[model samples]
Target: MNISQPGLFGNQWCDAPWRLVQETITGIQSLKSDVDFMLWTGDTVPHVDSGHLSTDLNKELVRNITELMKSTFPTMPIYATFGNHDYHPKHVFPPYNNEIYNATYLIWKSWINDTSQDANFLKGGYYTVLTASGIRIVAMNSNMYYVKDTATVNLEDPADQFAWLDSVLTNASTNNEKVILTGHVPPGFTTPRAVRWMTEAFNKKFIEIVLRHSSVIVAMHFGHEHHDSYRLFYNQEGTAVVSLFLAPSVTPWRFQLADGEIEPPHNPGARLVKYDRQTGKQLDIQQYYADLNKANADKKLIWSLGYNATDLYGIQDITPKSMGNLLDKMTSATNKDFKAYVNWYNTNANTSDKFPCDDACFKKMTCGVRHLDEDSFSKCLTAVSGSVSLLTFSVYSVFYAMLFVAIYKLFN
Candidate 1:
């Protein structure tokens, strides 16, 4: 967990230095040795202009990462999905197998250890593996549903993934097997802005499928947000049924939004999850991170525990009901618990002063988690957006009224 004068893990506010990746893998090995598998949600390539990248470059990037991963943990199973940037053009994934998918499947096929997954992965960049423990891992190509993706914008069920997903979940249920769903792009809205990640139609369908099969889904894990967050999915009955965990990026790069404002930078982070192999349930999550500033100053990269889900948040378990209660508690962005969530949102990045997270931000995030459906999300915001209590509002009204009277009297 220590680097030399060798201490600098690269720019804290920009793309990660290569050594950081190595350190992250090493850190994980040291921190948690019992890891059975890895769910890698894509974006193996660095974020750069298209002119600076191409099909060949994309394949190269994926190959390099895949090689490193294979060599590092030769025996462990690793499942991956494509991000918007994983392709040559960066945001267009056609339903058919193209050059990028072909090369990617070849590079990553061995990781699955199941030749049965080849057709799906090569066809539309998705596949599922039935693990030895009877737990099915569904690696979804969510990039096809991304807003920036143009290839399948007009097509319904572009890759027929929804149909495939429903069938998979149904089969898993029939076999009395649980599933761990992994994808790159998540459904629902973004945390930075209350924007949907997928098109309304696609997002709606995705949410519908999950809610339909909520009982069989052990957990849904996604990346691409580049921030640590979680979404709690609800059943048709409006009960919290599942939880989606979004792990922070290994890169500490701070991205600027379309509004041209640079996001608050966070330290590079990873998580060690304790789960049930038999039930495929995520029991706990231990977030670990390296302070970029501290590492550079101390002349060593040190990965330390950021927070424990059950310990810091006081959630009994990582179940959706427990997490739903936690979400309710964090609705007010100003609470101590919510403040800690903000801190870890960027892996302890100090944005509390320069980039203040007000009540509106909290509402958007919590609502997004509460309701994956777009309509419900918007309604949730409307129903629960007052940062000030009713009593406080009344007090302010009274004070303003008295001040207005005094000012009027003085003026008259």
Candidate 2:
């Protein structure tokens, strides 16, 4: 739910009470008939003061939502995991002095007992639920291993997590049960940067384990990216090991990027995933975006379920020409550069006409120019040098004039 924001006490649009009641009801109603189990992909509580009321409020909200669901679907089960924001970093140790953690755990335990009939539930954020169709859903807490030391948060993929995961996957595979794994973080970095770099060794190991039982592992659903997206990863065994499904944020946090694209206060939404029990195949997955203008909008009753694979498609190949080629194909015409192509592509690709590039000319050169020809590459360097020389001389002339004025003033 991307539960963030401090105003959870009131039932206003911007407050927790309103969002909770609205989203919970909306989610329940959306999947009332088709879904066998309702799985929450983490971030259940908004990260606020690590106190009893703060934690209790979140728990109460969940409890209320669970009761609401039960009233309709008499015996349906709801499962959840812990997000990094749910508990303070220091709560996971021998020195665990945090009252909030204890309180939160107690609240969760009570809720589980009250709401679910599942026997395999554990205290920590890891559990397995068997569906009526015999499909197993394994939910794990990826947030427990992270530690904040000084300025940086160290996210060491816990060895215990891997061991537990391995056992679960092995059991699922051996039992011939189709498994759907859930977590908060995506496997690797979608954005190429330092801070976002995840544990490569752990990611590879996890993927390898999943691949080993690829035949039974259908999909891995997660959140935290706050974007509706998906990626297909193939393993060495020639099996499409896992289909990563990221549900969109329930709150409006970020915006869609391409030009003319809808900016902030984006359409908040969630996903409805449908799986075929017989084939272990995902039949149809729909993304439902909220319509703000409607009454009880947060209830998501006035929303639309668009059938697009955007929630599952990973980062596109942004390599210039490939992007340009896509643009050309779409319009059945050639563009001079990547920017122009992207601009054109964005306009024609979706209902929103947004251009991703600002400098079409530069993108064109970067996309079209190759270093294969030594002479051409050298000539391009010379031209760049000439431009630099002209700019350098212009700057020098201004500096010289300033220096002369300063010298004259000093002499006078």
Candidate 3:
């Protein structure tokens, strides 16, 4: 559909039209001089149903986005991942090589610039690219963790990605190189619903892998939820080890899901992460976004800073420790920190119909952020929410006690 004036988020139903994509690219190009490389945690295709799409159509869509990135940043490298929607059948990635993989390898070979890692990318849509000194970028096909990817979901080690990830991380640790992990879907539930992206078993496995290699990994980035939120990876001791940043999508489509869940509209957001090239330590994330409503109305896009991570959250840096502290602040719904959390965490819609961020929402989000395993997430809600219920009962008891004293005084 050709929609020019797509308003930024309360009830917009249109996908990112071509003009919108062009304008978004223009906004990104504004940072060409300062930015180094790009992390395109993928979903090049639109949110169209599987029945209407074909393998060729999906391939073209990937190619189109790739070419746009190439044209925008001619010299800069873009490490991309395979999104579930990039597949024709959508979320049915196989353990074995396929037609699209080979095609993608050819289309992306220039950007990857390393034919040495060709085999793995062809086999299971993943590869590693070493940047400057002491840094490596592992573009994993996390779509394997996706629950609807039935071909590999039941398999204990889909695409052998976990094993490969372990080996890669082990190698990075030994080489004294820090790795930046990039993928499509992250290991947490969606920002709103405790939606199932990956199955419980896969999520658990993914979390284990992160914990095992937490020391060697410097930063992680993913995109899929299209919601501006992040996940905290904690070790068995409940200490945060790694942080995964989920960048909001360029597409502002409040997607029509099968289950009829509707997310409030959000402006198109792109994050520019500042980091130490030597240590691979992320310094900050500069989130840039255009007011979809204003831009569309004005017939031009003006991207501005939505917020900076360290500054807004009052955290020292974008690390697991700081992120864990942020999560802790978010525990209380009435707190100002959580108020800001709801604003930015909901993609800054501030729409009238925007859903309320109640204590229940906070509980689900907290558990989702802390526990990557679905089972652990459920258990966390049970333990925490159960206590909340008990606290409610205690408050009722105190109220009744006060009431009885007042009644006795009145009788006297």
Highest lDDT against the true fold, candidate: 1
Which portions of model 3 miss their true places by more than 4 Å? 1-11, 384-412
| Local accuracy by lDDT, each model | 0.74, 0.43, 0.73
Q: Which of the predicted structures, 1 or 2, would earn the higher lDDT when compared with the native? A: 1
Task: TM-score each candidate.
Answer: 0.89, 0.59, 0.89
In model 1, state the lDDT of residue 311. 96
Models ranked on lDDT? 1, 3, 2
Question: What TM-score should be assigned to candidate 1?
Answer: 0.89
Candidate 3 structure quality by residue, lDDT tens digits, 355-379: 6878877777667777667666677
At residue 279, candidate 2 shows an lDDT of 42
Give the distance in Å from residue 393's predicted Cα in candidate 1 to where it truly belongs: 48
Name the runs in model 1 displaced over 4 angstroms. Answer: 1-7, 351-355, 384-412
Worst 10 residues of 1 by lDDT: 397-406
Superposed by TM-score, candidate 2 places the C-alpha of residue 18 at a distance from the truth, in angstroms, of 1.8
Better of 1 and 3 by lDDT: 1
For model 2, the superposed segments whose C-alpha errors exceed 4 Å read 1-20, 27-32, 47-73, 89-123, 145-159, 192-197, 237-239, 255-265, 293-301, 308-412
